[model samples]
Target: MARATLIGFSAVAMWALLALLTDASGSMPPFELSAICFAIGTCVGLAARIFSPPPPVRERIPPQVWLIGIAGLFGYHFFYFTALRNAPAVEASLIAYLWPLLIVLGSALMPGEKLAWNHVAGALLGLAGTVLIVTKGGGLAFDARYGFGYAMAGVCALLWSSYSLLSRRFPEVPTTVVTWFCAATSLLSLVCHLALEETVWPEGAVQWLAVLGLGLMPVGAAFYAWDIGVKRGNIQILGAASYAAPLLSTLVLIAAGFAEPSWRILAACVLITGGAVLAAKSMLFGRDAKASAGAGA
Candidate 1:
């Protein structure tokens, strides 16, 4: 479980690069970029399969898995992009990033899972930290004009949280199944691109490389790692820790000179890190600390 949780963190780490990479990739349409990147992600899985093929029975994966998987990947992105288009980027993103908090709260419904004080507290802290990062300590004034985008952002949050929780329900399903999900998402994205967006390909070698990097890491291996973590790892901890993505992303952007350094970044870092530690107190200190405290008492 610990190992799988660490693997999940790797996904968060990769996601930190998402903003940087997307910025580097030229102004391609969202769906078109999604299609191309996901196609590369599909190839990544296919390449892995060449060495270690899935079991014959794994090929007959359930239809519901397909539905959930595609809905999760493509649905989340579609709504997210729509939300960004219809609303202010800062407001839309702040609303969409509620997934981690939703996951922490929703985990109580999962079998054998117990909601704890620290979990809720930590998740709230993480959400607060994320707000600082997304809004840069500025106030949010949501206008009715962008209500549709705000609603779409809310849906995006629910879809991602639901997807994460649902993945836990199918522990028997192999992570390799994400490959097919990526393939289907890529195809669907292509369709959406054709219908809704003008064709604008990556311009130069640097943009192309950025697209490839996105496909290989954030879009590709990240999903595979996340599946394993949600299925077998400490999900509550993972949920709280997910807030680190935006914080880290901001830092990455600052380091790359795409963004400026700010005090809010430091505050967000402290909050996010502290929240993760608080949420993972059990795993970090374990029974020995409890025993020592009890003995001392």
Candidate 2:
């Protein structure tokens, strides 16, 4: 559990760089960037599969699961890169972080999971934080310029939450199936890029580094580590812990001179983290108390 927790945290740390990397990609269309990143990830996945021992043939993955996985892997990155292009990274990241809250809320739809009040409250608080960030602490004038981008970020959050929730329904499917998901999305992204976007190759070390960084971390290895954490560790802790990514990412962006620190970002951080903790507190801590009580009695 401890190892998985550490791995989960490491995955989050890798993810923390995603916003900055996406922005650093420089003028590459979202579709093109997504295609490139997933292409690299596909290669890594294939290589890993080739070296690893094969599992039982009986654990056949269903086509429906394949469809869902592809949709999720493709949909999330597509919206995410587009959001980064359309909106400020700080705002886009905070908004994108809403997935944890959504994940908690969406879990109610799962069989054997009831809708809890704290979860609802947590989601609402997170929503409030998103509003604060989008409104720029109520200072930004109403305009269409970045609204679509913000909306795309919202969609990114929704797609991810939906993916996470649905993933819980099929524990039989190995996480390695994400490799196939990557392959499908890579192909889809390439088709979209060729049809709709202007291709721009990375021209310098910094730009190429951004491309490589994203392909290796956020899109590739991070997913594998996260799968281990969620499947092997205490998920509530990992889920709540994930709220740190936006804060960490924002700080990195500021440190890189890509963004200026602001009260809005700080407020959003507080609200989102607080909300996630509140939502997951029962699963995270209440189980421990129950176990203690059982042992004492």
Candidate 3:
């Protein structure tokens, strides 16, 4: 349990680096960065596959899983990079953190998953947090130029939330199958990059370092660690802890001199994290109630 918690924390740290790294990805088109980063991740996945064999033929994954998962993964990163490109890193990241809340709400749609009142309440709280962040604490003077980027970040949240729900529906799919997902996302990102952006590699060593760091840490090994932690660790704690990614990322950005800490950001964090805790209360603490309700039904 301790080891799993450590690994989960490490995964969260890696995820926390994503926003800062993406912000440092200067002048690289979003699709281009997506292709390059996922390509590196594909290599990592392939190497993992080589060292550790896949499941037997009887447990082969379906094409639909591949399509849906790859689409979600690729789409999330694509828009994520775009969001960082156009919007403030802290704000964009805070908006994207809405995924966890979305996941809790979306889960109710799954078979046998009930829509508890806390879930709706949490969703509303999260939405309010988003509004606070997006509106800059109700000042109401938003930059229209960044609207597309903000919208893209919202789409990123939806993509990841949907992906997570779909993954729950296909729990039989092995974690090792992420190799295929990396491969497919790499291919799609490549096509998009080639068609939409000019062929330009990282401009300098700093950018190159950022790109490599992103591919290896956030896109590559973080997912592996998360899988291990979720399979072996206290998942409820990890789920709650995952909300810290944006907060940590924002701190890292401020530390790196990219942005300044502000009241609105802190308030948004409070609201979002508070809402996540509220929404997850039943899952974390209401096991007796859940079982009793089920038995009664």
Per-residue lDDT tens digits for candidate 1, residues 113-219, read: 87888988998899999999988899998999999999999999999999999999988888888999999999999999999999998998999999999999898
What's the true lDDT of residue 8 in model 2?
A: 62
After superposition, candidate 1 runs with Cα above 4 Å error: 56-59, 288-297
Best by lDDT: 1
lDDT of 3 at 14: 95
Q: Please provide, for model 3 over 165-225, each residue's C-alpha lDDT reduced to its tens digit, 9 standing for 90 to 100.
A: 6765675676677767777787888898888789777778888999999889898777667
TM-score, cand. 2 vs. native: 0.78
Scored by TM-score, the top model is: 1
Clashes of each: 0, 0, 0
lDDT of 2 at 17: 94
Q: Write the per-residue lDDT of candidate 2 for residues 1-297, one digit (tens) a residue.
A: 556656766888898898899888777877888888988887778888889888877577888888778878898888887888888776776678788777666666667666677767766666676666556676434346789889999999898777767776776777788887888888999998999788888878899899988988887877767766655544444555666666677778989998888988888788867877776566557765465334324
Query: Global lDDT for candidate 2?
Result: 0.75
